[model samples]
Target: MPDTPGDAHQSLRDLVYVQLRERIIEGEYPAGRRLVERELAETMNVSRVPVREAMQRLEQEGFLTVQARRGAVVAEFGPAEAEHFFAVRESLEALAAQLAAQHATPAGLKSLERILTRTRKAAEAGRLRETVSLNADFHRAIVELSGNPLLQDMMAPLDGRLRRLFRLTSGPESTSPMCTEHEQLLAAIRSRDPQAAADLARRHVAGTRAFALSALGS
Candidate 1:
């Protein structure tokens, strides 16, 4: 049987979902930005069916909200929410770092160092947006290196949320601090020190939470 639109809807929907999700997480669709199906479909060069499906998924993911008159808009959270969210993220990612240290592979460490190199370049160029993305990539590499499926699943959503928060407060002052922290964290992991890696990861994430809160004037 030939493939039909119905059969492809799921695939198309997933593709559309990822694109929209990336845009939202990267701050392209900032908080309260109205997401119009027509606009998104046109922008993505696709029909509204997949766009609508993706938007619904995004709403379910806490990245969007269906309002009375606003339709779908990017979700926003309060300062307290930010604090709580990062606190949980910090805890989980610290666990990831600990596991990564225990299971650190040469290839995994090499991949992390490559990401760190790119992050440094992005930061040196003073591109906060790109830096935020690279920073996300760096931490994501670490989390994935941990090889824990549960940790991977839990940190998935927080990754997007963290990217959004990082973009908000990822200033020049934030750049060098994180670069240094990344080095320490990497060194601990490389040295096979799980406790040290966990401690560094926690402090690093805690510092980011503080930076974000201060940026929010909290």
Candidate 2:
């Protein structure tokens, strides 16, 4: 059967959803910023219908919240929510690291090493945005190495939320420590030491949580 217009439209909406979601998480749309369907549709060169669908998708993803009269605003993270989010993420990432250490292929380690190198360069160059992207890539590579689709799926949402928080607080001081942690994670993976990898991952995430809380004055 030929692809219907509806299918094409859904694909377009999904694409729009991804773009808008990233912008929101990157703080381009900052907390309490309203997303107007017409404006977004015009900006993205798509129809209002697709923009609406994209907005709804982001809202469901917890990146946005629809108010009774305020329209759609970017979601805000509070101290409590931030604490819980990072705590849960720390646990999950520890498990992912342990699994990856046991299962990571040579190719996966190489990919992670490449990303780590790129991340270090980005941090040194003061390219905060690129550093954030590379940081995400490094963790994603490790998650994929775990050989658990379900665990990867579970990590996806947490990763997105964590990226948003990171972007909000990332600076020269923050990036340096993060770069060092990434190197340690890579070294652990290279040694194929599951316990060390898990310990390092946990400490890395905990450090981030503390940094984020301090920056947020929480």
Give the number of the best model, judged by TM-score: 2
Instruction: For each candidate, give its TM-score against the true structure.
Output: 0.90, 0.93
Instruction: Give the per-residue lDDT digits (tens) of candidate 1, residues 1-218.
Output: 22996768878888999999888776788889999999999999999999998999888778899999779999985587688888788889899999999997999999989888888888888978777888899899889989999889988877777877777667888998898899899999999999999999999988888888888775
Candidate 1 all-Cα RMSD: 2.3
* Candidate 2 lDDT tens digits, 82-158: 89888788988999999999999998888988888888898999998999878878888899999999999998877
In model 2, how large is the Cα lDDT of residue 70? 85
Q: Give the Å shift of residue 102 in candidate 1.
A: 0.1
Candidate with best lDDT: 1
Model 2 clash pairs? none
